[model samples]
Target: MAAWPWKSLARSRQPTDGGDSAAPGKLSLSLSELFVVGTWFGVATGLLELGGTLAAVKLMGRVTYDTLRTNWHYFWMTPLSNLVLFSVSALVLCVATARIPRLRTGRVVFFLYAYLTAWSLVSAIPTLHKTAEVVLAIGLACVTTKFLTKRRSTFLRIAPRAAILGAGLILAIAGVDVYSTNRPVDRGPSVASVAAVGPPNVVLIVLDTVRADSLTPYGAERDTTPNLARLAREGVLFKHARSTAPWTLPSHASLFTGRWPFELSADVGRPLDSAFPTLAEQLADRGYATGGFVANTQNCNAWYGLDRGFDHYEDFYENATVTPIEVLRSSRLGRYVVTSKLAQAVIKRAAAPVDFRYRKTAGMINRDALAWLSDKGDQPFFMFLNYFDVHDPYQPPKEAERRFTKAGGEAQSAANLARDAYDDCLVYLDSQIGRLLAELESRGKLQNTLVIVTSDHGEGFGEHGLAGHGVSLYRSELHIPLMLVHPTRTPAGTVVSEPVSLRDVAPTILDLLDLGTAPTFAGKSLANTWSASAADRDFSEPVLSEVDRADHVPAEVEDAPARRGRMRSITANGRTYILNGDGREELYDLHDDPEESNDLADLADAQEHLHQLRELMEQVTGVQENGE
Candidate 1:
């Protein structure tokens, strides 16, 4: 009868394996005994990996369980999972290697199997690539078993110990990383101390990726934003407004903190740093209930730390529930099988008939906003709402889609299709805006609430070789609509053409509410514009927009020596100067070439303007003029 592997390991009293001892004088383990030790090594390595991650997260602090659950797929619950997987892989490899009668031969095969299995399990995709990796692992295991089966007593005993020691060193390094990560600083006031009384409600609506030119108020050929036009009729519109960055996250960070986008740490996978004070924190400290409802999951999700200081932050994925079994599923071999190309094709074919409706649409967001407003109970509120309908891959409702597309339209160009879809989304968003305003008016909340509508950035449709934002500092991505409506309606329909930065939004909100600006704010308050004499008003401060090319790079290249090339655009004195990372410059006369089709960088007459804008860029970023 065959002896159980563990029992065999226990009965072996002397070092019989044909190798030297792990230490100089210790007895060398036999084949079966070595199997037990190898299994321990694998399990220990796995446990250390998983434990380290958990410890790191705990040390970081301020992370809620819901946030962990929402972001769990990013890690696949790696700690306990690694232990289980490594233990099983070790046991299976040992059993297969045991077929070789020679302890020395079996040891070599076992180590090879272990190495291959571990490498195969490392993955960045849950697709055919994973299947290929697992197949390669199994192939290596089979070959190791077949070719290295000759039984011999002469083998080096030190190899196994060396590998085990290497793993231990790796685990120690991982532990250091966990303990060394910087803890986020606590900045805001405690929720318990917040008073329920002072300041009028402030509503900041960010129209994600919507360019100023797309709106009717900005002279678009299409009536893309009639509701926005209506707001413009009763509010102040700034025609030359610009975003701080050509993307959602950094630009929004600038809006919230009233700082330049360059001042914030930009990492899509992580939350915003807790060191900066947010506008919500400012308001909450002065007795305002702050809430945020955003549709952009990539940058605005609560996991990203943008939810700081808000009394309530609603993200579509926040309520998703993850079971313990679901956490373990990613570590299983069945995951590879289920994610195989054949299985995926079958699933896609089967599910083709089911229409998937987007959960984070403008209507759904407005519904939640209305519900939140109903429950506030007269406490002054600060609300931030972001509508992502105008962003890329724009798919509006069927009615809107049909209206934008021809009734029986033949094949259209990609640009036309994109444009139509974009316009349709704007129209749909406009309707939702109308609904939101009507609700506020009906509830009599409009009379006393200050409303500000703007965008984080704009979208591009293949202009300057870019279809989306974050790649360039073009006007298409920087130019955004900014409209402000006062509660008392003193300066109705005033148009401010001087270039203004999105960073100004926070200071303006505070200024309008009679709240003194926080010392940390870097933006100038536009509240003075209402009362400042025309000559005293300073439009000389350049509106700066920046772009980080690193943010636009694909995830596959993340390990590449982070080549973070940054670009800055300066709009001042009716001219726009875009300083490229490679020291190239593009100058556009905003009045003569709003489309930016003509670049006057080489024009001799424009040299002084270029030099001035270049200096302004350097002053803003604190980087030298030579692309330092």
Candidate 2:
């Protein structure tokens, strides 16, 4: 309840020209002054942004470094937007200040900044009063009033600087992106005599959220993966198929580009950067028909530029016609309370085709993939399936959950039960897999074609206080099931203990297809691990994972925004992981803490292991120790 000093100062005001002032009659808010208000708004927006982000982190438990760096991005992304908003705010405030007004612009702006910053801090902290956020928000209005009254000249200088900094940062990142990406790698490795017109149509099925161990073939309790198990008996089942990332985008990116998650992680929301070649693109160039069906729009052709290689590149699922009520219930308050109406309106407009079902509108995708074969239009085919069933809001139909857990919604409400639902979804996915496999077989293309079954990452249903992923570096998050089913693979029904990452998938697929070798590929081919002798087996390489949002993890409550996805740690050999979060680095031996409950970072015995892992991560990612 700070009193407005600026308003009092203006009460007994006199004109600079010593003329008879008309009692500051009607407050005037012009278009130009409004624009300046917007300029001031740009300066103040960071505080509101900081508040929102802090609240998100408080609820989610962690925030990635890159997202925090988005502040660095807003520094540029919204200049014109700021102009429009500030212009409007300024006009209204000016109009009020002149007449029927008790508000001061400069005072209000200053108070708002203070209120928002304090509120965010209070929200982020677990201790203290619960009303901190409300108090802070109310206090901000006074700050805004003060801010609006500040001399117009200071705003002029600040506005341009803010815009420039953001723009500069954006340009710099773009330049680096251009250099890092742009290699035309996928195009270079051409297949010799690329088969055309039904040379064993290949179906690369990607089961979203499908874990390697969930299948009964892998000794799970439920017959959840009946179809996949049957396929295992008929074809080669790679006991170990690991995805490079714990999330969908990077994992799929690795599959498409044969790169590791760390390398491809930055490519999320962006395409494959046009430098790398995709299997579909490669096949299309060689007169092969390429088509894909996916359940999620994030994995669509448009966002990631995946539709480039196909002639009939159809992603009709963009506008989901049907939606579930469960999703409606799951919406957050913030979704409606987007501080700005424009932002809220934009979100609503874009979300017209939103879906909350276990099965998205994927029937069209299946039909399209199947159609590619029906036409058999004088071309070989490379088909793909992206199943998004296993992701969050794990709704596996009420009946399926009943089969696994005794409790219904109550059980499914728990993390472990959701995992059970995920398993059910996997089972359903397997049935779909069966249908695809049968179609391929009916066409007489099963024997000669290479079948690769794998996941982007595993699900973590409250494995460690964490309900889902993008939070930790635990084995539950990183260790994935990787299987490669080939027509003439000599090592059938064989279990390989060698550690593997999703990075090698690209190179392995290309190798099998008689395409070019992966010179720049950081992963070793699984075929290499299947050496005839199997005597000298150092089959796996040190695997690295990162979560730039340190505080996003439960373990990192303090020390926010350290190293943006720098290097949380690495899993060397297969057992040890040297983890870095919140400025402290720890070592864990999976031999002992498979649950990752124990820390061995200080253990003298782990010195060599830790050194090697750190070195390995540094070499691949180009990230180093703070002092070093």
The best candidate in terms of TM-score: 1
Which consecutive 10 residues in model 2 have the weakest lDDT in total? 326-335
For model 1, residues 1-628, the per-residue Cα lDDT tens digits are 1124324433544344444543221243355545544545454444443444344434443333223333223243343344344545556655664654343334343444444344434332223475566555555544543433322232234445644565555455545544543344333332222222345788899999999999999989988888999888787889999999888878988899988877886455445786789999999998888889888866776666688889988874322323333333334332443356775677588665322223367887887777666667567889899998888778875554445756544488777888888898998999999999987776667777889999999977777656666667888888999999964643887888888899888988888888888878878887656557898876465588877656455553333111247677899988999877666798999999988989999999999999988888888888786744
Q: What TM-score quantifies how close candidate 1 is to the native fold?
A: 0.70
Model 2 per-residue lDDT tens digits across residues 538-598: 5656565555544334443222222335445566565555445445676776556666778
TM-score of 2: 0.60
Off by over 4 Å in 1: 1-198, 268-270, 318-339, 342-359, 398-401, 550-564
Error of 2 at 503 (Å): 0.8
- Local lDDT at 95 for model 1: 68
